[model samples]
Target: MSVDPVEQWSGVLDRFEADIALAVSGGEPVPWNPPVEAEAGPLPEELADRARRILDAQLESMAMLGKVRNDALAHLDALSAVPDSQSSAGPLFLDVQG
Candidate 1:
């Protein structure tokens, strides 16, 4: 099925927002804590790298969302300025006065 561009973009923004929330939560659902010094292995570089990427994605998503929101608001305002057919064209029949 074809998806509207705006709607598709909106979904992307939503996903990014969710990702940001999860990242901000410090990977609570999954164990995110770095391995302790006594641990045999060092912290996973992949985790740190993934976190950075997520942060970048979150920033980009926020910027896109802001632009899209502003554009939508502007479009709405412009649309509101146009008079409806009834208001612009008046009544079809004239009123007969006594």
Candidate 2:
């Protein structure tokens, strides 16, 4: 027997919720799942609407996370580019005057 569309959608939603939680907390990475094509039938309006809302939030969170990660990487690169006297293997000198 074929799987019910509602059940398939519910599974998708459950996985999505877990992924969102992990993403927000910076936990283990969530593997990408292929998109699920809807069967040839209409889903309950309420279910569809709720799923859409969840999807929209997920997309927004993903975007924000990407931006934060990119920003952090950029900052690290900038810090690495700066010249540091400590890098050289030589005697260090410090001058203090009152």
Q: How many residue pairs collide in each prediction?
A: 0, 0
Per-model TM values vs. the true structure: 0.45, 0.68
Tens digit of per-residue lDDT, candidate 1, span 1-98: 65444444444445555666765554444444432345323324434555466668878766776887799999999999987877766776677994
For model 1, what is the error of residue 49's alpha carbon versus the real structure, in angstroms, after optimal superposition?
A: 1.5
lDDT of 2 by residue, 1-98 (tens): 88877776677677788888888888897578654455524555657877888889899988999999999999999999976877867657656773
Best by TM-score: 2
RMSD of each: 15.3, 3.4
| Worst-scoring 10-residue span by lDDT in model 2 | 35-44
Give the poorly placed runs of model 1, Cα more than 4 Å off. Answer: 1-46, 88-98
The most accurate candidate by lDDT is 2
TM-score of candidate 2 versus the correct structure, residues matched by position: 0.68
- For model 1, what is the alpha-carbon lDDT of residue 77? 100
- lDDT at 14, model 1: 50
